[model samples]
Target chain A: SQQGEEDPQALSIQEGENATMNCSYKTSINNLQWYRQNSGRGLVHLILIRSNEREKHSGRLRVTLDTSKKSSSLLITASRAADTASYFCATDHDYKLSFGAGTTVTVRA
Target chain B: GAGVSQSPSNKVTEKGKDVELRCDPISGHTALYWYRQSLGQGLEFLIYFQGNSAPDKSGLPSDRFSAERTGGSVSTLTIQRTQQEDSAVYLCASSLEASSYNEQFFGPGTRLTVL
Candidate 1:
């Protein structure tokens, strides 16, 4: 399977704290993407970082990619209760994405 | 603009029965994909369609799984003679094209329960 793996299967942080998730994948990829799922519902695209990109930022979300190690990390700064969800990292190759087992985040109100 | 849409948000069927899940892509998008997610698991690609070209079914797990896209817009996934293991959330996504750089827009998935 081309599917990747995400570490720290679960996380709990204060509403104002930060949450970070790491992902590692096998095989070459053109890009990697982060998605957020609320209560097992549909996934919302969070960010996409290409293989050549080392870091990218959007709002409170920061993503870093290290193609040399075939790994990436997502940082949600100053997370809120609304940020509680499952985060998944997918490797994009051949126009398809192999998703990783997500990291479930729980934010304390 | 409206995002992707799916029908029959939840379904429960017998192991020997069949089920169909539908997906509607964003307007003018040329790429559609089908995926399945077992409880507490990650997404598994089932098939992919680019415009009117033949779909890539390399990810389909068994012969009981099949899908079809009509007019490059809407798609349907059919599971025949389903087994208890077939229970999962079927998700659909659409992108502007088949490029790896494109971000896909997902639809609320259809939850299938095989009893």
Candidate 2:
């Protein structure tokens, strides 16, 4: 069974708009990480938020983690067509990281 | 430094034939992991290796799937009697340590197609 599940399986927005994706997990975790995958390619690491932290930022990406709710959200600001990709959330537990089904976001021109 | 790397970025094999996939982790990384991703599906844990400790084969779906890590550096995943369901991208990852907070760096992946 998978440890994490992502909501809004797919999303589409204009290039300049912002996009938000959510992830929920079932167990305790030490950290939650986000990854992006282009069509027909492997995943690329994005950002990681520790269980002890509430939010972290890097460039146009922002991630927030709420351990109490066992959920996390990723926000991509001022998106671009190049931002089009499938996003996944992974939770680290007991030394192994389990990934979610993922959210596919399309940034239209 | 170079990141984790996987060989034969793409492989196509006929059904019933055997296939071997290889992965080379980053230098000095002790933790190696293998995962399978089917089309539109999440990553499924396949196996894990840390240093010289016994590799974790618990996630293997069947007896036909096996993997090994030699010298605690390079790892190989072998599938015997390939099946259509076995077609997927095989990903390899390695971390500096197995600590809960350590992030895993992924390889480009070996795309395996079982006809």
User: Each predicted complex: what DockQ?
Assistant: 0.74, 0.70
Cα deviation in Å at residue A72, candidate 2?
0.2
- State the TM-score, rounded to 2 decimals, of chain A in model 1: 0.97
- Total clashes in model 2, counting residue pairs 3 or more apart in sequence or in different chains: 0
Positional deviation of residue A70's Cα in model 1 after best superposition, in angstroms: 0.8
Which segments of candidate 2 are over 4 A away from where they belong? none
Among all windows of 10 consecutive residues in model 1 chain B, the one with the lowest summed lDDT is B35-44
Q: Indicate the TM-score of model 2.
A: 0.95
What lDDT score is found at residue A28 in candidate 2? 94
Clashes of 1: 0
Which lDDT tens digits does candidate 1 get at residues B1-115?
Answer: 9999999999999999989999999999999999988965558898999988899999999999999998888899999999999999999999999997799889999999999
lDDT of each: 0.93, 0.91
TM values, all candidates: 0.97, 0.95
Those runs of model 1 whose alpha carbons end farther than 4 Å from true positions after fitting are none
